[model samples]
Target: MQNSLQGIELFKASVSISHQENCASGTCIDKNLLENYPPELIVGFQLLESVERSGTRRFAIHCGSADNQQHNGLLAWVFNTDLRYSFKDTSSASRSISAKCAMKVFYKHVANVQPLVNPDLGMPSVTSLEELRLPLHIYHCIKTVLEKSTSLLPPSGRKFGEWEIGLLDLESA
Candidate 1:
C-alpha cells in the first residue's frame, strides 16, 4: 500500500536526519545517544510466520523500534488474507510471545470475518500485495540472531504494544 511504503520511507528519512544532527555536533556519537533516538523514528517490521488456507495467505508481522539494543517492544500486525483486511493488535503481553501462538491468534480472530476491503487502504488502487514487501531489519537483527539468537529478542520486562501507528498518527502534523 502507498501509505505503508510512504511510512517506511519517512522512518528512513527521520533516522538520516537524526544521524546528521548527531554528526553536526562535532563529537563522537555516544552509544546511548544512538540507542535512545526516539522509538517512534525507528520503526521496523518482520514477517514472523504466514499461513495459507484456501486461496488466501495470512501473515503475522512483528513491528517496532529497529533498535534491538534498546529495551523497546514490538507491535503485532496481522494480514487477514481471508478477509482481505489488515488489523493491528496493540495488546500488552510478555515481551516475546511464541511465534506459533501469535500465528494462531491472528488467524483465529480474522478467520470468521467477511471479506472486505481494508479500511486502512482508503480508496481502491492498482497496487497488489504481492508487489509490496514490508521493510525489515535484516542486517541489524538477523546478524545478531545468527550469532546469538537471544540477542535479538526483546528484553523480558519491556512493554509491548506501545508503537505508534506509523505515519498515520503524523498525518495532521
Candidate 2:
C-alpha cells in the first residue's frame, strides 16, 4: 500500500505525495496526483529532524465519553522518507515546510516501509492508532480506499462500520 489520504481540509495542513520509488505518498489519476492512494504503495518514510519535530503535530479532534472512558488526543503520525528535504519551525501549518517526507508514520525515522500494526497487538490489524486521528475527509477517504484495496481492517472483516457516525453523536467529555 502506497497512497493514503492526500489533500486539504479547512482545519489542517496540506498533505501531498512523492512518486519517487517508495515515497509512500499519493499516485496519479488521469494525470493528476491530487487523488488519494493506498498503503501498499508506501515505501520508506522520510525522517523529520529534531528541529522539524516541533509544535502540535498531534491535535485534539474530539473530547469524548466513548471508545474508552474518555477520548482526548489523536496524534495522527503519517510520513515518507527524503533526507535532502530540510524543515524549519513555523506556527502556521499552511506555511509549514512539508513534513510528508519527514515524519515516519509510526514515529520511526527508518527509510523503510514498516508494518502499520499495533506495536503491542502485532496481528489481525484492527482499527488501531495508525488509522486514528485525522480530518473528517481524510478519515473517510482512507476508509473508502481500504474498502477497495486489500488493506488491514477490524478482525470482524472488511467492514469499516455498520453505520456512519457524526461528531454530534460523540459524547463531549
Candidate 3:
C-alpha cells in the first residue's frame, strides 16, 4: 500500500546538518569562493533550538519519522535564525540581515505521494512534494516560534532563503 511504501522510504531518507567548521573570516580564504561549511544558525535554527545551550557552538539533530511509526504527514522540527546584518559597501554601516532561516524538511509519508509525472498516465510534472512540504512546515514552525518568542512581530513575508528540504540522503560520505 502507499502508506507502507512511504513509511519505508521515510525510514531510509532520514537526513541532518551540522556545523562542520568555523574560523575568522579575515584570513586569506578566497573571497569569491564560499566554502560549503556546515549549516549555520540561518540553516540550523530548528536543530539548534532543540539542544541545551553550551559553551561553544555544537549540537546534534535527532529527527526521525515520528519515532519510527507511520503517519500521513508530521512535522519533524523547526526554528528560526537571529536577525543578521551585513554591509553592502565599506562606507556604509547600513546592513541587510537575512529575514528568514534556511530550512530542511523530513517528510513522513513521501514515496506514497506519487510523482506528478508517470510515463503511463503522462500527467504534467508538477512541483516536487519536497517543495510543497518544506515551505508549509517552515512557515508553520516560524509562525509558532515568533508568536511565542516576541509579541510584537512583523507580518509574514516571502521566503528569502534556501531551504534544504525533501527526503534526506544519509549515505553520502
Candidate 4:
C-alpha cells in the first residue's frame, strides 16, 4: 500500500548520559543511582529537502527526563516547512491540512518508538538505559491534549475518545 504521509529523512540522532555530575571522574560510583537515569535525547529531521516545492521542512528533538524512566511520550513541532502559510493564515484550508499532516508525522514517530517505551512484558514504572526517557513535561502535554480533545466530544463519544487517541495503548512508564 502507498503511504499518504511524506517520509521523514533523519539527519541526525544521538544519545548521551544524563546527570554528568553523577559520572564524576568518569566513574559511576553510585550504580543504583545511575540505573534508569534519563539520557539526553536528540533527533533531527530534514523532510523532503530535495523537493523544490517542499520548502524548508526541519525540526529537532532535544529533551531529557528528570524522572529517569522510559520516554513515555514525544514532543514534536514543525520548525519550518511549506506549511508556513498555514500558520500565517489559520482560516485557510491549508491550515487544517497542514495540522493533520503534522500530527500524522508526530504520531508516526511515537508509534515507531512505542515498543521501546513500553516493553513487551508489561509497563514498568522506570525505564532502563536502553529505553527512551520521556520528560514529565512532554508526558503532561500529551495527557492534557488527549483530555482536552475528549472534552470536546459529546458525552457518549467521550467514552471512546481515549481509545481513538491511542493513549490507552501507550502504557505509562
Candidate 5:
C-alpha cells in the first residue's frame, strides 16, 4: 500500500503475516492477484507495446507458426535492453529501441524504481526495483516491474491465443 516497495519491509516481516506474500506480485488481495485479472489484458498490454516499438503489426498474427516466437523475442528484448544500457542512442548500430522501450514500460509499471548510474560506481543500480525482483523472478519475470505493480493482471494469467496474430501466433501485432 505504500508508494514504494520497501526491501526492508519484505525482509523484516514474515511472509505468513500477510497472505499477500503468497501471491506472485505480493499485493494484498482477497484472493491471488493472478486470479483477479483477465488474461487478455496482460497479453494485450505486452503485444501492443511490442508492436509500437518495432513498428510491426504482423507479429501476433503469425505467432503460432513461428517456433519459440515469444521466447526468442524475450531473449532478444533482454539482449537489446542490455545493449541500449551499454550504448545509449548510438547511430548505425543495431540500436535496441525495443529493449529500451520495454524497460521504460517495465520501470514505470513494476516498482517505481528509477535507474540511476552512480558516478561513484560507474554502473546502474535499482533502488526500489530490488524489492520487486523476488516475486517477479518467482513469476518468471514475465511482466516488467512496472507492469506487475500497475497492471491489473500478472503475466502468468495472460492469454496470447486471443490476440490478432503476427508472425507465428506470437501476438506481436
Candidate 6:
C-alpha cells in the first residue's frame, strides 16, 4: 500500500476548509480556528497523509504561514476525495488564508530506517526491517497461521509444525 505512492510529486490545488453547521455550536475542536480570521486569496498548503475510518477517507493537510514570514505549523483535515487530484468549485468559496502571506508548502519529515539485531539470529546477525517484504499472499498465510495458533481459549500453548517460508522475488514480479 505504501509502495504505490513512492516518488509521487506534490501538485498545487484548492479546497474548501469550511465550517460545518455542527461546528458553529462551539462543540467542535476546530470551530474557532477560522473565526475572525481573514481569508487570503491564495494560501500555501500541503496535503500530508490520508487516514480512513469505516469506509470514508479523511485527508490530513499541513498548513502554516509562508516560510519567508512567521506562521504557526497548524494542521487541518478534509474528509472527501483528494483535493490535489480533482477540481471542483462555486458551492463553497475557497478562502485564501494569511495576512501579508506568501503561499508555502511543508512536507512531513522522513528518514531511513536503522538496522537492528535480528532476534532469530540472536547476537550474531544484523537485519533491517525495511528489507523484509510482506506481500499480500504471505501476509494472509501468516495471518491464518496466527489465527489458528490463537483460536483456542487460553491459547492451548501448542507448538505447530515447521513453517514453509518463501521470498517474493521482485525481479520476477
TM-score of each: 0.21, 0.21, 0.20, 0.25, 0.21, 0.16
Model 5 reaches what TM-score against the true structure?
0.21
Candidate 1, residues 1-173, lDDT tens digits: the string is: 24634553443312422243537664666555453332222222222222232222322222223322222212223332122113233354544332211121111112211112222345553222211112455223422322232232346512224421111111110
Model 2: residue 106 alpha-carbon error in angstroms: 16
Model 5 spans with C-alpha error above 4 angstroms: 1-35, 61-173
Stretches off by above 4 angstroms in model 1 are 1-26, 36-77, 80-127, 130-173
Candidates' C-alpha lDDT? 0.27, 0.30, 0.30, 0.33, 0.28, 0.25
Task: Please estimate how well model 6 matches the true structure, expressed as its whole-model Cα lDDT.
Answer: 0.25
Off by over 4 Å in 2: 1-13, 16-131, 151-173
Candidate 5 lDDT over 1-173, as tens digits, reads 32354324341111323334556665545633333223223443444555467643322111111122222112111111211222234464776543222222221122212222111356755332111122223223333322343333345533233321111112221
Error of 1 at 88 (Å): 21
Q: Write the residue-wise lDDT of candidate 2 on 142-167 in tens digits.
A: 33432332233234432223322111
The regions of model 3 sitting more than 4 angstroms off are: 1-112, 115-120, 127-153, 158-173
lDDT of 4 by residue, 45-153 (tens): 1223312244322222223333334443443332322321112336666664332212212221343344443445756632321232334454454445545544544
Minimum summed lDDT over a 10-residue window in model 4 is located at 164-173
lDDT of 3: 0.30
The window of 10 residues in a row where model 1 has the poorest summed lDDT is 164-173
- Model 6: residue 23 alpha-carbon error in angstroms: 66
**Better model by lDDT, 4 or 6?**
4
User: Model 3: clashing residue pairs?
Assistant: 46-79, 84-97
Of the two candidates 2 and 6, the one with more favorable TM-score, higher being better, is 2
What is the TM-score (0 to 1) of candidate 3?
A: 0.20
- In candidate 4, list every pair of residues with a backbone clash: 71-132, 71-134
Model 3 lDDT, residue 165, Cα:
22
Of the candidates shown, which would achieve the greatest lDDT relative to the real structure?
4
- 3 or 6: which has the higher TM-score? 3
